[model samples]
Target chain A: MSTTEPKRRGRRPNGADTKEALLTAAREVFAEQGYDAATVRAIASSAGVDPAMVNHWFGGKEGLFTAAVQIPINPAEIVREVLEGPREQIGERIIRRFVTVWDGVGGGQFAALIRSVAGNEQAVTMLREFVQNVLFNRLVKVLGVDHPEMRVALCGSQLIGLGMARYVVRIDPLASADADAVAATIGPNLQHYLTGDLQLLA
Target chain B: MSTTEPKRRGRRPNGADTKEALLTAAREVFAEQGYDAATVRAIASSAGVDPAMVNHWFGGKEGLFTAAVQIPINPAEIVREVLEGPREQIGERIIRRFVTVWDGVGGGQFAALIRSVAGNEQAVTMLREFVQNVLFNRLVKVLGVDHPEMRVALCGSQLIGLGMARYVVRIDPLASADADAVAATIGPNLQHYLTGDLQLLA
Candidate 1:
């Protein structure tokens, strides 16, 4: 049988639009009902699409979540930017990039994210994925370091703790202080966490 | 002042028992409904006492919360124990104590406490009080070192982060890890955080 080549392969005019619509709906549903509580049918209904479409496009809720929360910054790209120059200075870049994301999304997004994690099981899974895959995994690979997992987890904890105190809990001074000010205060410790001389103590 | 002194001096016979009962009720309510949602009336009702009893006994809700979550271990006692021995070994003792409290409480109490922090405003306030007054305040006083407040806060962040990862999220290895093992892994860093040389980088 003679086969014809596909008409247009690069970009589907409507595909991006549908994906965005579904993602927005999925985020709201997950936020409201949590992971176990939100259903595919509910998400599809909210998106004004057939339930079968979600399965066809996203594979399932897990896939939809991964797609929805994917940060615009590419992990490989971030690793390159962060790891360039002497390893000693990497911590500042890391902190600055993290701060940029927080400022770009604003406090409300972080609050919503924290709420989702507290309220929903799926949200925790998603959070673990975002931290482990999108951020920590790449950083570990780039650092090519020992205790990579613990180091990544430790960095995550430090950053998250700072975020919780500054944004979620709204602790005095930290909450009210300028973003650059905080980055200056906490950045070096984080850098040390990533590539510091821990073996010296050992 | 003289007239009031007599009233204060002539205490009720069962005052201690009643106060204990109220505290028990307050803990249950605070654990279940968190601080803000757990009304004084409800706690009193649970305790089978009038709402006025809470006022008569603990001053108000905030005071009641202080009593509810108070740990028996004194920070002064802890600092004394640490400082009594070699400064280098203080880290191990500190880590041991932390593990003891976390294990003693069982995961459920901590889960309830964390859930309360997530769900209730009053719980957050009460938690802040407990962290600030009973925990951090004591640590700061006993450490008797420079930047005591910041040091204490940072130490708290590490401990709380460890708890969140271990108990709430149940991160493996660490979650099921033996108490002593965990103490060894995290203790030295925490020790450095508490009393090590942390002069600002040039």
Candidate 2:
């Protein structure tokens, strides 16, 4: 009884497949209902798994969410690349690299995620976590700039804004415009955010 | 028979009040269901009037939407203010003035309106019209930059990003932070967007 019950209690029938199913289900649920309103039961139902499995695999809803939408980007990787080049060209590289990621993702996922923030509470929180923990934290470590954290936050605002125009709201001409053109236009401002002497009164 | 039906064709029974009620209902319905999903009949019902009243007053759904969320600002008035000041300081003034409007509105109406774009096709189209026709068109005149239209669009990206951070997502210290503080922090970047050296390469 002890052995059989313990085995049944902890193990998922199809462990890896269950986890994948949960993630897929979580993405759909999170995207649809947003972070706050989405429930574990709904996600479990969507995945056809036991609610206990969610806790066993991912701790809880937040952990499951982290696993679902958390992009595995190492900011150090980005910083390393940006800093490896000449310091003066950092802005161009930074902007170009950012445009590359959004462009590479085909704009739909990122755009959906960004546009979803306005209506859903959980989406907004998850979005902040993704930006703060995944993106901004990484940028601060790599740049080695003075006031790097503030600089990273500021730079993030620029990129987020660019995404809104280019993808979410799809402001024409700019929305449909070429990637290189955006990089060239916005790169410098982001660079300034990272290293410029932006005095408060100035 | 003609006299019996005459009142139906005459000026709306209680024209001004009916118009105001329609505008109020339109904003809520448009905010909730968006432009396409929101029916003239529904708006009329919400306003306790006839559907024909919408067509009579605003010409159609587009006009009704225009009247609903439209923030009445004279571009000429704003542009004249910018042109009067030192051209270089135009960016800062514009940023400050823009913030004042958002603050005056207290973010609820605009935030709800902005948030409603999700999962709705009609709302998206209406948002595009509002931004391009109403918001950006006005900003372009005031920018007075080398490429006035392009600069205005870029500035719009910057401003919207600030709004997302400050109001929508309410990110960090910026969210709870004072209006003056935000203006001081982000105004210059916007200022630069308006009048900075476009040649500065990243």
Model 1: per-residue Cα lDDT over A1-202, one tens digit each: 5386565554366666667778889877865654556788999899987787677779998788666655444677778888887788687777677667776766645555665566456667777667766787788776787777666665766666666665565554445556565556566667766777543223
Runs of candidate 2 with Cα error greater than 4 angstroms are: A1-18, A21-56, A59-62, A72-76, A88-90, A141-153, B1-14, B28-52, B59-62, B72-76, B137-149, B177-180, B199-202
In angstroms, the error of model 1 at B195 is: 4.7
Q: Per-residue lDDT for A96-202 in model 2, tens only? A: 77667767657655555664576666667776766666666666666566755556556666777777767777676567656666666777777777678755442
Give the top-scoring candidate (TM-score): 2
RMSD to the true structure for each prediction, in A, is: 5.4, 6.3
Candidate 2 lDDT over B1-202, as tens digits, reads 4546565466565788899999988877876764556889999999999999899999988778767766534545666675576766666676676666677767655565566555555666666666667665666554555756556567767776776766676666555556565666677777776777655333
DockQ of candidate 2 compared with the true complex: 0.38
Clashing pairs in 2: A35-A122, A35-A123, A36-A122
**Collision pairs in model 1:** B35-B123, B36-B122
Candidate 1's C-alpha runs over 4 A off are: A1-11, A25-74, A176-184, A196-202, B1-66, B71-95, B141-149, B191-202
Model 1: residue B65 alpha-carbon error in angstroms: 4.7
Error of 2 at A113 (Å): 1.2
Alpha-carbon RMSD, candidate 2 = 6.3
TM-score of chain B alone in model 1: 0.78
lDDT of 2 at B93: 73
Q: With candidate 1 superimposed using the best TM-score fit, by how many Å does residue B135's alpha carbon deviate from the native?
A: 3.0
